[model samples]
Target: MRVLITGATGYVGQAVAVALAGAGHEVHALTRDPGSDRARALEDFGVRPLRGRLADRAELSGMLAGADAVVHTAFDPHDPVGADRALFGALADVGGRRHLVYTTGCSVYGEHAHAVLTPRTPVDGGNLRARLEAELRSAGLPHTVLRPGMVHGGDARSSIVGDWFREARSSGPVHRGRRDKVWSWIHVEDLARAYTAVLRAPEEHDGRAYLLADARPVAPLAVVEAAARAAGRTDALAFAPVEDEKPVYRVFDRDEVIDSSAARDALGWTPQESDVLAALPASFRQWSAART
Candidate 1:
C-alpha cells in the first residue's frame, strides 16, 4: 500500500516511515525543508521526501492523490488547531474510502490522576479532545484517531524525558515530582509499529480512537531514578510535588497511563518492555560517540 506520512521529520513520523518502507510499502513523506538533515535521513530510509507544509493546499491535495492511507503525525505542539484543521481538510478531499489516521496525544485526556485511560475511559481535555474528535468524526473520511502516551525519544529539545534527565544530572542526585504519581509512556518505535499496524488493519476500526501504551503505569520518581541509573548516574534522587517544580516541567509533573487493550486486541499490537528511559539506546550511543 502507498502511504503518506506527515511530520516525516519528526521522531514518530521518521520511525513510522522507516518501518513502512522496510515492510516494502511505498512511503511518501511531507516536510517543510526537504534539504534538512532530518529530511535527508528520511530520504536515506527510501521514503519519497515531498517538499511541503501541511497548510499548503496545492501540495497537500496533490500528495493525497494516490495514497492508500495517510498518517497525520504533524501537529504543532503550540497551536494544534491550524494543523489539525488543514490536515483534516486535506483528508476530506481524498475521498472517504482511504483511511486517514490522525495522531493525537493522550495529554488531551489531561492528567489521569490515579485512573487508567482505555478507549472507553472517560476523557476530559477542556474541550480540546472533543473538538478534534468531532472533526475526525465529521470529516467525511475514513479515520482512526490515535492518542499515544508520552513519546519517549525525539530530537533533544523534543524529548521531555531527555530534558528531565539532563536536568537531573545538573541538579545533583535526581529531582523528581510525586514519586508515586503514575506515568504512561510509549517507545517511539512501539508507537510507530502501532501506527503501521492500524494502517494495514482490515475493516474493524473506523472513526475509532485508541490509547497507545504498555501494560503498567510507571511512577515518575522511579523513572527518574531508572533514567539516572541508565545514564550511569547513581546519585540519590529528590522527590518534589508538582506544585513545587519549575515551569520547565510542572505540567507534565502528574500521573497518567493509557489502556491499550483496544489497540492490542484490534490491531494485534503488543509492546515490548521498552521503558521510556530504557528505549534510548541509539541516542545514548550517539551521545557517547559525540563526546569521544
Candidate 2:
C-alpha cells in the first residue's frame, strides 16, 4: 500500500513510518524541512516526504492524489482552529479513496477513566486535540480514530516524561497525584504498530474509534523511580497534591489504565509494555549521547 503520513517528522510519525516500511509498504511522509536529519532518515526508510504545511489545502489535495491511504498524524493541539478543518476536509474530498487514520489522544475519555473504553466510550475531551477528533468524526468520511494512552517509549526526550523524570530526580522526592490512581501507557513503537494494524484490518474496523494502550497502570512516581533505577539513582518518592500548580504537569492529572481488548481482538494488537522500566537504560543512554 502507498501510505501518506502527516506529521511524519514527529516522534510517533517517524516510528510509524519505520513500522510501515518494515511491513512492506511504500510510505510518504509530510515535512516542512526537506533537508533535516529526520527528513533524511524518513527518506532512508524509503519514505517520500511531501514538502508543505497541512494548512495549505492545495498542497494537501495534491499530496492526497494517487495516494493509497493517509494517516493524519499531524495536528497543532495548541492551535486547532488554525489547521484541522483544512486537513480533514481535504481528505474528506478524497471520496473514500482509501483509509484515513487520524491520530487523537485518549484524554477524550476524561478523568472517569477507570471504566473500560472500547469503541463505545462517550465522547468528552478537555483539550483541543480531542475536541477536533470528535469534530472530525462528524464529517462522515472513511476514518479510524486512534486515541492513544500516555505514551512511553525508548525516546527519552520525545515527551512530557522527561520533565517528570527530571523533576522527580531533581526534587529528590517523587510525589504522585491522585495517589492511588491508574494510568495506561503505550510504548511508541507499539502504538505505531497499532496504527498499521488498524489500517489493514477488515472493513469492520472502519468508522470505529479505539484506544491504544498497554495493560499496566503505573503511577507517575513509580515511573520516575523506575527511570531512577535504570539510571542507578535513588531519591525519595512521594505523592504530591493534584493542586500543586505544577500546572504544566496538569496535562496528565487523570488516572486512566485502559483495556484495549477491542483493538487486541479486532486487529490482533497485543502490546508488550510489561517491563517499561527496562526501556530506561537505552533511553538514558540516548539522552546522554545527545547531550554530549
Candidate 3:
C-alpha cells in the first residue's frame, strides 16, 4: 500500500513513516521543506520525501491522487478546523473511500479525575482537545482518530516530558504541580507502531477512535527523579510545585488515565515498553549527550 504521511519530517510523523516503510509499504513523506535535514533523514530510511504544506490545496490534492491511505498528522492546534474541512472535502471529491486517520491528544478527555477514560467518554467543551475533536468530526469522512497520551522520548526533542528531563539536568530541579497526578504516557516509537497497525487494518477502524497510551501512568516527581538519578545528581534534585504561571508546566499539572484496550484488541497492538520510569533516566542521559 502507498501511504502519504503529512508532517513526515516531524517527530511523530518521522517515526510513523519509518515504521510503515520498514513494514514494506511505499511511504510518501509530505513536508514543508524538502531540503531540510529532517526531510533528508527520512530519505535515509527509504521514505520518498515530497514538499508540500497542509494549506496548499493543489499540492495536497496531487499528493492524495495515488495514495491508498493518508495519515493526517500535520496540524496547527489553534486553527485546524479550516484545513481539516478542506482536506475532507478534497478527499470526498477524489471519489474513493480511502482510509483517513487523524491524530489528536488524550487531553480531550480533559482531567479525568475520578473516572477512567475510554473512546466513549464525553469530551470537555473549552479545551484544545475539544476544538480538535470538533474539527475531526466535522471532516465528514470515515476517518480513524488516534488520541495518544503525553508522548515522550525522541531524545528531549519535541517532547514536553523529555524537556522536563533536560531541564532537571541543567536547572538542578524540576517543578511539578501540588497534586500527585498520574499521567498516561506513550513512547514515540510505540505510538508510531499504533499508526502502522491502523494503516494495515483501516477497514476495521473507519470512523472509530483509539487511545494510544502505555499500560501504566507515571507520576511527575518520579520522572524528574529518574532524570536526576540518570545524571548522577541525586543530591542536586529538589521537587516542588510551580507557584507561578509557567505555560509548559500547566499540562503536567493535571491527572489523567487512558484505556487503550480498544486499540490493543482491535489492532492487535501491544505496547512492549512497560517500564517507563526505568527508561526515563537513560533517555535523559542520551538527550544530554546529544546537546554537548
Candidate 4:
C-alpha cells in the first residue's frame, strides 16, 4: 500500500514511517524540510519525504492524490479542531482512498471517575483535538481513530520524560504538579507497530476507533525519579499543589488508564512494552543523545 503520513518528521511520525516501510509498504512522509537530517534518516528506511507543511492545502491535496491510505499524526495542539477538519477534508477529496487512520490522544476520555477507560467509555469534555478528530470518524469518511496513550521512548526529546531528565540535571530536585496523576504510556516503537497493524488490516479497522495503551497506569513521580536516575541524579522529587501558579507545579494533572483490548482483538495489535517505567532510562539515553 502507498501510505502518506502527515507530520512525518516529528517524533511519532518518524517512527510510524519506519514501521510502515519496514513492513514492505511504500511510505510517503510529509515534512516541511526534506533536506533535514531527520528526513535523510527516513530515506535510509525507504521512506520518500513529501516536502510540504500542514498549512499548504494545495500541496497536501496533491500528495494525497496517489495515496492508498493516510495516517494523520500532525496537528496544531492549540488549534486541533481547525487542523483536523482541514486535513480530513483534503483526504476525503482523494477518491477511492482505502483507509484514513487518525491519531488521537487518550486525553479524550478526560478525567474518568472510573479507574479504567475503554473505547466504549462516554467521552468526558476533554481535549478539543481528540474530540474533533472523533467527530471526523463518525462523519462517514472511512476513518479509524487511534487514541494512543502518553507516547514516550525513541528520540523524543520534547516528551515529559525528557523534561524530567533535563530538569533533574540542572535544577537538582524535580517538582511536579500532582504526584498521584497517573496515566498509561506507550513506547514509540510499540505505538508505531499499532499504526502498522491497523493500516494493514483496514478491512477490520475502518470506521472504528481504538484506544492503544499499556497494561496499567503509572505515577508521574515514579517516571520522574526514573528520569533522574537515568540522568545519574539522586535528587529527591518534590510535589506541589495543582493550584500553585508555578509551571512545574502544573506540569501534569490528569489520570488516564486507557484500555486496548478491542484493538488487540480486532487488529491483532499487541503492545510489547508493558513496563514503561523500566524503559524510561533507555528512552532518556536516546533522547539525550539526539539533542547532543
Candidate 5:
C-alpha cells in the first residue's frame, strides 16, 4: 500500500510514517519544506518527503491522487479546527475510495470524570475536537478515527511528559489539579503500531473509531516523581498544583481513564510499554541528551 502522512515531521506522525514504511508500504511525508533536516532524516528510513501544506488544496489533492491511503496527523496548534476543516475539504474534493486514518484525542470525551471511556462513549459535542470529529464522520469518506490518550515517549522534548522533566529541573514538576487525577497514557511507538494495524486491514476498521491507550491509568504526581528520580533530583521534588481559569485546562483536573479493548480485540494491538512510570527514567535521559 502507498500511504501519505500529513505532519510526518510531528511527534506522532513521524513515528507513524516510519512504522508504515517499515511495514513495507511506500510512505510519502507531506511537508511544506521537503528539503528540511527532518524531511531528510525520514529518507534514512525509506520515507519519501513530498512538498505540500494543508492550506493548499491543489497540493493536497495532487498528493492524495497518488496515495492508496492517508493518515491525517497534522495539527496546527494556533488554529487546529480551521486547519483540519481545510484538510478534510481537500480530502472530499479528491473523491477517491482511499482509506483515511484520522487522528483525534481523548479530549473529545471532555471531563468524563470517573467513567471509563470507550469508542461508544458519548462525546462532548460542543468541544472543538468533538465538532471536528463529527465533521469527518459526515464527510462521506471511508475513514477510521483514533482517539489516543495522553501520548508519552519519542522525542521527549516535544512530549508532555518531557515538559514535566523540564519543569522538574527548574522550579519543579507542576500538577494542574489534584495529584490523584488519573490519565491514560500510551507510548508513541505503540500508538504508531495502532496506525499500522489499521492501515494493514482498513476494511475491518472503516467507519469505526478506536480509543488507543495502555492498560493502566496513572496520576500526574507519580509521573513527576519518576522524572525527578530519573534526574536524580528526588530530594528537590517541589511539585504543586496551580489554579488555571482556562476551560481547556480543566482536562487536567478530571480523570481520563480510557478503555482500549475495542482496538486490542479488533486490530490485535497490544501496548508494548504500558507503564509510563517505568519508562520515564530512560525518557528523561533521552530528553537530557537531546539538550546537550
Candidate 6:
C-alpha cells in the first residue's frame, strides 16, 4: 500500500510513518520543511517527505492523489478545528476510494461515567474533537477514526510524560486535577503498530472508530511519581496543584479509562507496553536525549 501521512514530523505521526514503512508500504509524509533534519531522518527510514500545508486544499488534494491511504494525524494546536475542516473538505473532494485513518483523541468521550470506554461508548457531541469527528462521518468518505489515549514513550519529549519530567526537574511533580483521576495511556510504538494493522486492511476498518490505549488505566499522579523516580527526583516527588484556567482541564479531571478490545479483536492489535510506570526510566532517557 502507498500511504501518505500528515504531520509526519510530529511525535505520533513519525512513529506511524516508520511503522508503515517497516511493514513494506511505500510511505510518504506531508511536512512543512522537507529539508529539515527530521524530514531527512524520515528519508533515511524510507519515508519520502513532501512539502505541504494542511490548510492548503490544493496541496492536500495533490498529495492525497498519490496515496492508497491517508493517515491523518496533522493537527494545528492553534486552529485545530479550522485545519481539520480544510483537510476533510479536500478529502471529500478528491479522496475517491482512498481510505482515511483519522486520529482523534480519547478526550472526545468527555466526562463519561462508564468504567471502561469502547467504540460503542457515546461521545460528547459538544466536545470539539467529537464535533470534528461528526463532520468527518457526515463527509461521506471512506474513513476510520482512532481515538488514542495519552500517548507516552518513543521520544517522550513531545508527550505528556515530558511535561512531568520538566515539572519534576523544576518544582516537583504536579497533579493538575485530582490525584485519583485515571487516564488510559499507550506507548507511541504500540500506537504505531495499531495504525499498521488497520492500514493493512483498510476496508475492514472503514466507517468504524477504535479507541487505542493499553489495557491498564493509571492515575496521573502515579505516573508523575514514576517520572520523578526515573529523573532521580524521588525526594522531590511531592505533588502540587497547578491552576489551569483552560476548559480542557475540566475534562482531565474525569477518569478516561478505555477498552481497546475492539481494536485488538478486529485489527489484531495488541499493546505491548501495558505498564507505563515500568517504562518511565527509558522514557526519561529518551526525553533527556531529546533535550540535548
lDDT of 1 by residue, 53-120 (tens): 87766568788888888888887766678777877787777654778878877656654454677788
lDDT of each: 0.73, 0.73, 0.77, 0.78, 0.86, 0.87
RMSD (Cα, Å) for all candidates, in order, is 2.9, 2.6, 2.4, 2.4, 1.5, 1.4
In model 6, the Cα lDDT at residue 170 comes to 83
Candidate 6's C-alpha runs over 4 A off are none
In model 1, the clashing pairs are none
Q: Per-residue alpha-carbon lDDT of model 2 for 1-292, expressed as tens digits?
A: 8888888788788888889888888898888887887788788888887788878777887888878888877766566566778877778776665778888776565545445566676766665566777677687667788888777675655665655556644655455565555567888889999988976752667788888888776776567777666655665566566665643355456666667888888878888765566666676665556456
User: How well is each residue in 1-292 modelled by candidate 6, as lDDT tens digits?
Assistant: 8998998898999999999999999999999899988888898889999998888887898888878899988888988987888888887778488999999887787756777889888999998999999998898888999989899997785788988899877877766766778889999999999999998889988899999999888998788888888888857456445467676667556788888898899999899998999989998888788778
Q: For candidate 4, write residues 139-210 as lDDT tens digits.
A: 667778888887888865556777777787787746556567787888889989988998777877777778
Candidate 5 structure quality by residue, lDDT tens digits, 142-220: 8999999888887675677888888878876566677678889999999999999998889888899999999999987
lDDT of 3 by residue, 79-108 (tens): 577676667766776768678888878667
Q: TM-score per candidate, in order?
A: 0.87, 0.88, 0.90, 0.91, 0.95, 0.96
Better of 4 and 6 by TM-score: 6
The deviation in Å at residue 77 for candidate 2 is 3.8
> Measured by TM-score, how close is model 3 to the native structure?
0.90
Ordered by TM-score, highest first, the candidates read: 6, 5, 4, 3, 2, 1
Judge candidate 4 at residue 39 and give its lDDT.
Answer: 88
Q: lDDT value for candidate 1? A: 0.73
What is the TM-score of candidate 4? Answer: 0.91
Model 1 stretches astray by more than 4 angstroms: 112-114, 153-157, 168-174, 240-253, 274-283, 286-292
